[model samples]
Target: MPVKAKATYESVRDAVNQLEKEGKEVNPTNVLNLTGGSRSTVYKFLSQLQDEDTKRQIKKPLPELEDLINEQSTAIITSLYEICKHRAEEVVLTEYETMKKRFADLQKTAEHMDLIEEKYQLKAQNFELQELKLKTENQELKEQNKILKDQVQTLKEQITALNKIINKQ
Candidate 1:
C-alpha cells in the first residue's frame, strides 16, 4: 500500500490559490485533489479561507474610501477658494479704476474753478483803476468851478461902479 503525505495549512492554501488562478472553483473536492487531503480536512481549511476573505473584504475598503474622500474634499475646497479670491481681486480692480476716474474728474473741476478765480481777479483790478481815474477828474472839475465863480463876482462890481459915475455926470 502507498502512503499519502499529510497536507499542511500552507499546502491547502496554495492549492486553493492555484485553483483560483486556473479559473477553477475552490471546492473541497478540488483542494483535496491538489493537496491529497481528506474531504473533512479540505472542508475545514476552505471554511477558514472563506472567513479570512470575508474579514479582508470588510477591512480593506475603509482606508481607501477615506483617502478618496479626503482628496475630493481638498480639491473642492481649493476650487472654491480660488473662485472667491479671483472675484475679490476683480472687484478691487474695478473699484480702483472707478476711483481713479473720479479723481481725474475732480482735478479738472478744480482747474476750472482756478481759471474762474483768475479772470475775476483781473476784472476787479481793472474796475479799481477806472474808479481812481474818475476820482481825479472830479477833483480837477471842482477847482475850476471855484475860479469861475470868483471872476463873475469881480465883473458885477465893475458894472455897478460905471453906472454910479454916469448918473453923477
Candidate 2:
C-alpha cells in the first residue's frame, strides 16, 4: 500500500516557516520535499498561510505618535476590528466549502457501494434459480430410471414362464 501523506495544518505551517527561515521560497514543490506532503495539501495550506500573513499585515499596529489623537486611535481600532472580522468570515467560508466537498464525496461513495450490493444480490438470486432448475431435472431423471427398471423386470418374468412351458413339452 502507498504511504499516506501527513499533511496537517501545523505540519504545513511549520514547513513553510522553516523554509522561510532558511531564506527559501515557500512553494508547493519545496514544501512537499520538506514535509513529504501531497501537492494538493501543500497548496491548500499555503493559501491559508498566505491569507494569515495578509491578515497579520493588515492588523499591524500603527506607529506611536508624539501627539496621539483620540479620533485617530478610535479609527485605527475600528479598522483593525473590521479587518479581523473580514478575515474570520473568509476562514469560515473556506471551512464550509471544504466540509461541503467532503460530504459530497461521501455521498458518492455510498451510492457506489449500494450499486455493488445490488449487483451481488442479483447474482445470488440467479444462482439460486439455477440450483432449483438442476434439482428438478435430477428428480425427473430418477423417476424415468425407476420406470425403466420396472419394465425390464416384467419382461424377465415373461421369458422365465415361456422357458418353463417349453421344457414341459
Candidate 3:
C-alpha cells in the first residue's frame, strides 16, 4: 500500500492561494483535491487564511474621500460585503468537510490500534506458553537429578560393603 503524504499548513495554504489566484472557489474539497491533503489539514490552513484576512481588514484604515465619491464608496462596500459573504460560506463548508475527514481518520486509527493490541496480546500469550514449557522441563530435570544422586549413593554403599568383605577374607 502506498503511504499517504503528511499534510502541512504551508502546502495547503499554497494550494488554496493558487486556486484563488486561478479564480476558483476556495473550499475544502477543492483545496483537498489540489493539495492531495486530508480535508482537516486543508481546512486548517484555510481557516488560518481567513483569520489573517480578518486581521488585515481590521488593521486597515478606511480611505478618506470627498463628498463626490460617496456613491463609489457605497458600491465598493456592497462588493466587499458580497465577497465576505461568499468567503464565509466557503469557510463553513470547509469546516464541515474537515470535521468529517478528521472523524474518519480517527476511526481508522482506532481500528489500527485495536489490531496492534490484539497482536501484542497473542505474542504475550505465546511467551507465557514458552515460559511454562521451560518451567516444566526444569522441574523434570531436577527430579531426574535427584534420582541419579540416590543411585550414586546406593552404589557407593555397595562398594564399601564389598571392600569390607574382601578385606576380612
Candidate 4:
C-alpha cells in the first residue's frame, strides 16, 4: 500500500502554517483541505512536522525523533506544527506557572504584614487607656494628701493651747 501523495511536503507545511495563522485547528483534515492531498499522506506529514518541532524544543536530538525521521524514506520535514503545540504551549505553561507562584508568594507576604499591623494597633490602644487611668488615680491621691496635712496642723494647735492653760493654773 504505497502512499500516492501528490502535494509536496512544502505545500503541506505552508497549509498548516496558514491554518495556524488564521487561528484554525491544525488537524489533518484542515491541512488536507488546504494542501489538497491524500488523507494518509497528510497524516504522515503532520506527524513528521510535530516531531521535528518537538526535537527543536528539547534543544537536542531525541532518539524517538531520530527513529521517526529515519523511518520515513521520504524527505525530512523541519517545519512548524498549533503553532507547534508541544513546544509553544509548553513554553506558555511554564511562564504561566512561574507567574502564579510569584503571585501566591506576594499574597502570603501581604497577609503577614496585615497581621503585624493589627497586633500593634490593638496593643497601642490598650497602653493609651492604661496611661489615662493612671493619671486620674494620681490626681485623687494628691488631693487626699493635702486634706490630711491640714487636719494634722489643726490638732497640733489645739494641743499647745491646752498645755499653756494648765501651766498658768
Candidate 5:
C-alpha cells in the first residue's frame, strides 16, 4: 500500500522515534495520531519501514520472521532473526549443559552418601560384636570366681575335720 502517498514517511518516522524517546511503545494508533493520518495509513507506513529493514537483510535470512514479512523483505528480517536466534540457541545450550553437569554432581553426592552410610553400618556392627564379646567374657569370669570360692570352702572343711581327729587322738 504505498504508505509514502498517504502519509509523509518522515512524519511517521519522527512520531515513532519521539514515542520511543518518551519511553513508550510505538503503537500504530499513536503513530496515526502523531502523524495526523488514518490507522490504515499508519499500518502501511510501519509495514513499509519493516519492508525496508527486511530488504537490508540480503546476506542472511531468518525463518520465523520470514512468515511475518513479505518474501522480498524476508531477507532483511531473516538475517537479523538468524543472528538473534543463533545467540539465543547458544545461551540455551550453555544453560542445558550446566544443568546436566549439576545433575551429575548431585548423583555423585548421592553415591558418596550411600558409601558413608555403608561404612557407618559396618562400624556399628563391629561395635555390637565387641559389646557381645565383652558380655560373654564377663559371664565366664564370674563363673570361674564362683568355682574357686566353692573349692576354698571345701578345703577349709577338710582341714577342720583333720584337726578335730588329731585332737581326739
Candidate 6:
C-alpha cells in the first residue's frame, strides 16, 4: 500500500476510535448511521483494521484516537508487505518451473542431434571401407589378365616354329 493509502486508513481508524470513546459501538454499519462517512468508507476502514490487528493486544485505553491509529499503521503496512512478498515468491516459482522444463526439452534435442551425427559418421566410414575393397579387387583382376596374355603369346610362337620345320623337310 502507498503512504497516502495508509494515511487515509489511519484517519478513518482515528475517527472510529473517537466515536467509540464517546460511548458509541464501532460496528461497520453504524459509521453511516452515526457518523457522516459513507457505508463504503466504513467497510474500507474495517478491512484495514482486520488486516492491521489480527493478533494485536490491547492492555490499556489509548489517550488519543490519532495515536492509536498511527500505532496500528505500521502493523497494517507490514501485513500488506508480507502478502505481496508471498505473491512474488509464487510468481518466481512458476517462472522457474517453466525454465526448467524448457531446459529439459533443449537437452533432449541435443541428444537427438548427437545420435544423428554419430550415424552419419558411421555411414561415411562404411563407404570408405567399401571403396577400398573395390580398389583391391580391380588391381587383382588386372594382374590375372596380364598373366593370361603371356601364356597365349608363348603357345603361338611354338606353333609357328613347328610349321617352319615341316616346310623345310
The lDDT leader among the candidates is 2
TM per candidate comes to: 0.50, 0.54, 0.46, 0.47, 0.54, 0.53
TM-score of 6: 0.53
Order the candidates by lDDT, highest first — what do you get?
A: 2, 5, 3, 1, 4, 6
Please report, in order, the local distance difference test score of every candidate based on alpha carbons. 0.78, 0.81, 0.79, 0.77, 0.80, 0.72
In candidate 1, which residue ranges exceed 4 Å CA deviation? 1-64, 154-169
Report the candidate with higher TM-score, 4 versus 5. Answer: 5
Scored against the true structure, residue 145 in model 3 reaches a CA lDDT of 95
Off by over 4 Å in 6: 1-67, 158-169
Worst 10 residues of 5 by lDDT: 1-10
Worst 10 residues of 1 by lDDT: 1-10
Question: Residue-wise lDDT of candidate 1 within 35-137, one digit each (tens)?
Answer: 8857777777776776677546445544677868865765676577668768988998999999999999999999999999999999999999999998988
**What local lDDT does model 2 show for residue 162?**
91
Question: What tens digits encode model 3's per-residue C-alpha lDDT throughout 1-169?
Answer: 1223755777777776788789999888877776675777777778778777755654555656543365466558657867987999899999999999999999999999999999999999999999999999999999999999999999999999999999999
* Candidate 4 regions with alpha-carbon error over 4 angstroms: 1-79, 83-85
**TM-score quality measure for candidate 5:** 0.54
For TM-score, candidate 1 versus 4, the one ahead is 1
Candidates in descending TM-score order: 5, 2, 6, 1, 4, 3
Every model: Cα RMSD to truth: 32.0, 7.7, 11.3, 14.5, 14.6, 15.1
lDDT of 3 at 149: 97
- Model 3 compared with the native: what TM-score? 0.46
